[model samples]
Target: MPTLTAYPLFRERSLLYLADMGNSKLKTSDSATAPLQLAREVLMIEAREVQALAERLDENFVNAVELILQCRGRVVVTGIGKSGHIGHKIAATLASTGTPAFFMHPAEASHGDLGMITQGDVVIALSNSGEADELLAILPPLKRIGAPIISISGNRASTLSRAATVFLDAHVSQEACPLGLAPTASTTAALALGDALAVTLLEQRGFSKEDFALAHPGGSLGRRLLVHVEDVMRQGDAIPVIEASRSLKDGLLEMSRKGLGMTAVLDEHGRAAGIFTDGDLRRAFESGIDIHATLMRDVMHRQPQTITPEQLAVDAVALMEQYSISSLLVVDQQDNLVGALNMHDLLMAKVV
Candidate 1:
């Protein structure tokens, strides 16, 4: 009963909607309307297929998981054609989720890529009909290698399924293609089944967000999980540290020298008493205060936002955005000045 959404306009019938919309047969005026109907019909078919396949989970799925979990070497996934493409994605998902999987093209297997598999490995083969020639060509060697096979296919009686130690049923009722010639619904069903296996294995392995972050450490995730405030914040002389008793002129001299647009004001005990920024100095100028006479403590914002060195850089970014500030003063657990960073620093690190 799921509603259909957008679909492939032409020739991308891979997502359970591979129906051959013979544009050659349609009248020019009806062409525009034909695509819409085709899209809706194909989407509906795929969604239902995904739902139905999900409900058809059986003991074979459990056996597949058990085999994968018991694997000593990496899981080698193989398939041909459209199924090969889906198998590649499933392998990626499995690897990123801590299952340690890789795709081995069946045709490439015949070209000696089969050496990638060892007795310690497990193989997940994909084919809608379970009868691809390239897949069958490597079955004997796969069997000889003593590696267990988990097959995902539309036919229970397929050669691939019959050869497997465990067979996961990804059979779909129909293809989204009007001619039933393309691998539409069957492919999606296989993908969903593969996802289920990967996710189930992920949970069984106790995979965590920290583990996922390690697998993806280049972008915002790295900034959030790997880069700490101390790793990126300016420390030592780079931080404009001044005493609260100092005059605004001295603060200005320190600020101008450090060029962080701000200076931290410390108390007699060397704890952060307050902070004075370029914005604060501008406001002070507007108020006509004497730069030589005003104490930094009196001219500064007394309660400034601060973070610990152990905090995440992304957290610092969040704090900066929330308060609409350009810089943040890094503090210790004892509230003493330790380091500082600005939006520009975040930009340089690509953390923002």
Candidate 2:
């Protein structure tokens, strides 16, 4: 008898067998390339499925969207298992994109949560097989409430699909899972279908980026999209202003008092002559100009950066960045100085 470890041929064969099993069970560096190819194939298959759904979109799809748009109540999406996860995401996407929607677990809905649905609401149910027992069990109660059902599933003949007022076929050719057991391609198809519905409804409703901002006021997009210069500018006494005949010392005093790092120098008629910023102060000091004797008109940078109060604050920030300047004088239609703002003002207002 020979020890298995001492036999070279046996050891080599065992190593090769282990490597083959590893490739089949876990995708490691040795099997990485094949999995990537499989992923591309799955994506292509899912994309085709989505395109098929898009092409088959007829008056029924139109009616579904119209139903949701006209409904005085929310859209309720429900599903079980992997579909439930997709339903949750779809519900969130719809809610954020101007559609009032929420996800209800079919199992939970049957267990007293069915009260969440009403006659005014539209229900979207997801079941790839269209035969989930819990989902099917809740269909009668939902239909009895007079809520229209939008079914997303592969099997059109299944109980849940047959119960729906409009069926959106989320059929896929194959699952990406090697064993064809997990919900991979099917979930992807369902998600894409959900996205299509959401985006279509969003466009039909004329959902603007501003509308999106209102839904997400705490995020950066809301700040960038909704904030106008008027909302962030320093108006009234907060503005640093001086007349043309004012001494440079007076301009500096206004800038210091307002703490905006600059002052707007107005002409005799109250229009802006120029702006004197801290940077301009440094230049004036280097030029040996006496702050007390020099008029601000003589030292100020004329035709300074100015923005309309109606301008978007994000655009104002772009102007500042492009000009490499920190402050802008805000003026109205008459060109009279209405306000002033700096990067600090934008920061304080959370518009930057």
Candidate 3:
């Protein structure tokens, strides 16, 4: 035969043909079509099942929420394997959303973490087959404590389901996994159900953004939502203020010195009478008025928009947005100036 190097082009063409045939075979085969098609069909089916579970959510979900809401202690979630992982997430979501909850590994419970459960607490157990022996090991004691049990599982007839005060069916008709061994569709359904329960309880309790702030104190939402205008506003000497009879020159000097671009004019009783800004100074100058000779009382904008120091900094931001202004004067009930807040202040505070 001719040397293989002498036939390199033919060899390369043959290899490309083989690769194309292999890909074509894959495209036309049951092996390639079956898994993806089955997963899509199963996902649709499971999605419907999940929706039905949500719609037909009987007194059970309601009772479970009520049980958690009325719980004087924590909600302990327990499971094994993949379900255990999801249970951990559910516990975290519940805890962060006003329900006091934490994950307790079933195996750990067997080794005395069972003491974490007590009377007036609630137990949320998750298992796909609902027959995990590890989960069952501590059930009798958990039941003895009179803690109401909420079960999330596939089989309603499983021992875990039977022991529950409320059972949420997380059954998927088929696994999204091709081998049907991996927890795919079932885990998705369970996670969604857990979220539904957490959010439902969150809404029913009339939980506010401020309440969320308490749970997430380290985050920006917590700081912005929880901080009051007084907490972030400039107070006392930091405030830009001038008396009613002060010269516009004096107000401009105060504005420049305080770096707030504005100064509040206080009346005879020390109440905020008016405000003068750099913009006002420009308009006054354009009118041929003498800045050094004119009284701030005569040229300043009167009865300036004011907010209470008790208002939320977020609310102060809204006020700034609504009025199209960059600064606001915070005052007490008697209209006496207490603080000053500018757009830069809110930005620096990250309240915006």
Candidate 4:
């Protein structure tokens, strides 16, 4: 009857020995490196599996893409467990890439989500074993609805595959999991296959950057592609402008009143002649030029960088970066100053 603390050293050594015994290759002296070694092995296994899946691609893969392309309705992706998680991602990728698609849980399909399926729609089912009960339960209904089934499964002989309109094998030789229980390599292969399908469809449809921007209107991509200088530039009274005959002091006042750190210098004909920035003012003062006596036309930088109102805001950003300037004059086709913008404006619009 020894107390727990009476043999702490012996107990610690016993536990270490047991851990090493669990994996014959792992020893007490190098136990610290076990996790790193195992992680690398897992990645290698999954990578190899995906590579194998690529080489095994045949006409079945092509036929599946053709089927989805011909489908007039949405592509409905479904699965259970880990497969269901991968299915959800695949559906999102497809939908965002121009192919109309959605994810429907297999278990939910049996409980009335099946009504979402239409005759013209296409179904992509994911199941490593090809015999998931939840997925299998929905197959007959999916078939009855006249939707074509594209099954991605490890077992071609499984019921799900046999019932498919086109079966693409996503088989992997082994799991990345040390115990060979978790769906690691298999899920990786399935996800890669799904990506291939989505990208192929995207290319086939000639999906463009503008189309992608439309789907992601709230994202940064949309801002860069969809937003124009006219949408973010300061217009009307907000634009700081002064006639060429105006003094540098007048230009400074306009710049301050408009709070843009620069003023547009307009010619007698009311067209943009040049620009007077704070940098010019500083240089004028350093050169001992009287601000009140110097005309804007004399002190302003001639032929300042300008952008068209219809130009993309991202292009304006590029122009600013290329010239190492912060502000830009927005002009019309006739080079008339219609608006103005600075780095701050682009920052506010999140275009920078």
- Which 10-residue window of candidate 3 scores lowest in summed lDDT? 1-10
Model 3, 94-188: lDDT tens digits are: 98988889999999899989888889799999999999999888889988888889999999999999999899888876665444678877898
Q: For candidate 1, lDDT tens digit of each residue in 1-352? A: 1213333343343332334354444233346675787778788989999999878888888988999999999999999999999999999999999999999999989999999999999999998889999999999999999999999999999999999999999998878876677888999898989889888998999999878889989757755788888989999999998999999999999999999999999999999888999999999999999999998988999889999999889899999999999988999889989998899998888888
User: Worst 10-residue stretch by lDDT in candidate 1?
Assistant: 1-10
- lDDT by residue (183-292, candidate 4, tens digit) is 99999999999999999999999999999999999999999999999999999999999999988888888999999999999999999999989898889989999888
Q: List candidate 3 stretches off by more than 4 Å.
A: 1-46, 144-146
List runs of model 4 lying over 4 Å from the truth.
1-28
Q: What is the lDDT of residue 81 in candidate 2?
A: 97
With candidate 2 superimposed using the best TM-score fit, by how many Å does residue 262's alpha carbon deviate from the native? 1.1
What would the TM-score be for candidate 2 when compared with the true structure? 0.87
Output the number of the lDDT-best candidate.
4
Q: All candidates' TM-scores?
A: 0.90, 0.87, 0.83, 0.92
> What's the C-alpha lDDT at position 179 in model 1?
64
Q: Put down candidate 2 lDDT per residue, 243-334, tens digits, no spaces.
A: 98989988888888989898999999999889988898899999999889999889889989899999889989999999999999999998
lDDT of each: 0.88, 0.86, 0.85, 0.91
Per-residue error for 167 in candidate 2, Å, reads: 0.5
Predicted structure 4, TM vs. truth: 0.92
Q: Is candidate 1 or candidate 2 better by TM-score?
A: 1
Clashes of 2: 0
How do the candidates rank by TM-score, highest first?
4, 1, 2, 3
